[model samples]
Target: MNKVLISADHVITGPADRVITRGAVLVEGGSITAVGTAAELDTSVEPEVPRLACPGATLLPGLIDCHVHLAFDAGPDPLRAVAEADPGELATAMADRAEQMLAAGVTTVRDLGDRDALTVTLRDAIAAGTATGPRVLAATAPLTSHGGHCGFLGGEVTTDDEIRARIARNAEQGADLIKVMASGGALTPGGPRMWQPQFTRDQLRLIVDEAARYGLGVAAHAHGTDTIEHCVTAGVRTLEHCSWRTAEGIVYDPPTARRIVENDIAVCRCVSGDWRLFLEQMGPERAEAMAGVIRDMRKEGVRFIAGTDAGVPGARFGDYVGMLEFFSSLDFSHAEILDMATVHAAHALGLTDTGTIAPGMRADLIVVDGNPLESLDSLRAIRHVLTAGRPIGM
Candidate 1:
């Protein structure tokens, strides 16, 4: 462990807390040991500690992305890119993407899909200091029907034996969580329709229980109404892209929404930086309808976890601030949106130590040129990013 003193013009300790002016934090043993006015820390910290000062910047907890795909290229044809690349090359590319995320001030990410647990290897590499990347929580390969969405990644099961075996295998591979594609997805050509269910109610329950055997939470990639209902009943810890999709348009099922709120299942809406482009592609009327649904869900006590679905088509690892800005379309204030990315997302992912910049918290912090509480665009002016007290390579 190393010691470092970080001082900034302003520091945001939590989303709800008032900004601390002339703030300084002491990092020791990869954790924050002190947080207060820079003047107080100037005398309290040992003289041997190295100090880094940002005279006109705001310091805050590092951003967290709840859903990302380290395997895809974020290109016009992400599937083709993954399909065409060699295994070793794909892993190398994945490492590069993680570094991109790091440079963008994303300190933690939950990688929901990758081929052959490549993210697991990358996670370990980053942890061991052999690679430069964000702290990764990998889902390895998302569970799906034999030919369902993202089946090419190799998580496919049809029978009870196969399902249990795969879950066990994922646990063995050190997956932080289990990801199940509960419904069809646009990314998988020839797969079931987006509104179609991939698993029966009984099968969904089985997957949840099997993952629980390993003390792992299950995150479901659910889009349709019925499947979202199924996921809620099955106790999924997180719901990815719960758009309430149907054949004609988006549907807002009030009762299911209530259940999701009551059960406290965090929703990752999967909006990316190119949301405005998507809005144009989806048409204004549909976009308005979806926005209404999002607002209603928030009103019903559903706060979203920030996710870029990065590496999907048109979603880049470098524009996470853009994704948070998209939340404004749903009428969330800058403060509310900031919580969704930091403290709220940390809780959603069961990581309690890394979200807020407070004493005893992990030293995962970022400093930017302007106050993010006022304008999220300030996040784009990243001055520094540190994970576990070590400054990341920009």
Candidate 2:
């Protein structure tokens, strides 16, 4: 068994609200053995064990991205690229993308979409130590209506039997969860408009039922108001985007928002890292409308998790820290923002062992040069990262 002790100036542990100054964590066999003030742990470990001491840094649980697509290259036309690349080429690109995510201190990611079930292959490779990357909960391919959003990824299913069969295929392929496209999207040109509903209420319910039989949670990609209502009524576990878009404009349905809060369904609002560019593209009127909707949701006490929607145009992997700034812009406290990336995100993804620094937890941690509680920009200055007690070469 390998053992290592890491000491830092401050340690943020468990919930984002708690911190320990002059803290140290002991790792044994890829699990945290202890977490306490450095003085308290100084004499408890073996003298021969390796120790890493950083005098002015903060240690935190590795960040989690609730939604990402490892297969897309963040190019202007990721859909086109996916269509052109063979399976091998897509897998190689995904491997490289995963490394970039690890380097950025994203230690866990939920890949919500991919081609040829490539994300599952990368997920397994990373688990077996054959590849270097974050712990991945891969969806393989997302279920979409025929010719609906993201239909080109080959997850288009129309009938009830087809839906159940597709769900079974993904489960057999080792998918950690299921992703369903509940509405249209901007990425798929000439598809259903962004505010248009794709899956019927019955269809969504069937998907949730089938996924539940396999003990897999269903995450719905919902941007339209009608679609969000459908997903909430269908018992989906998580709602991605949740933009509340209508053909007239952005609208916040209080009843739907209340239902989401009451049911404890998590909402992943994937703000682009280049938000300023996004605002410019969206123009002032539309951006303000969207921000207003988010503000209303926050006021309604909806649970929000941080996700960059990485792999989309203008949203790159390794930009999770930049994406945090979007939450900050919404006037969220730094602690609340950190919780979204760590504790809340972990709960959303059903990852119980790796979200926080504590005894019995997986030793997935990151050290930064400054205090993220005071300034989120500090997170970008990553000094070191450990995933499952294994140091990632920076």
| Candidate 2 Cα outliers beyond 4 Å, as residue runs | none
Candidate 1 lDDT by residue in tens digits, 135-176: 999999899997899998889999999999999999999999
Q: Pick the candidate with the highest TM-score.
A: 2
lDDT of 1: 0.92
Q: lDDT value for candidate 2? A: 0.91
Per-residue lDDT over 1-394 for candidate 2, one digit per residue giving the tens place of the 0 to 100 score: 9898889999999587899999999989888999999988889888899889988899999999999999898999999999999888889989999999999999999999987788988998998989999999999889998988899898999999999999999999898999999999988988899889988999999999999999999999999999999999999989999999899988889999999999989999998789988988899998888889889999999999889999989899999988899889879899999999999899888888988888999989999998999999999999998889888983
TM-score of each: 0.97, 0.98
As a whole number from 0 to 100, the lDDT of residue 196 in candidate 2 is: 94
Stretches of candidate 1 off by over 4 Å are none
Worst 10 residues of 1 by lDDT: 11-20
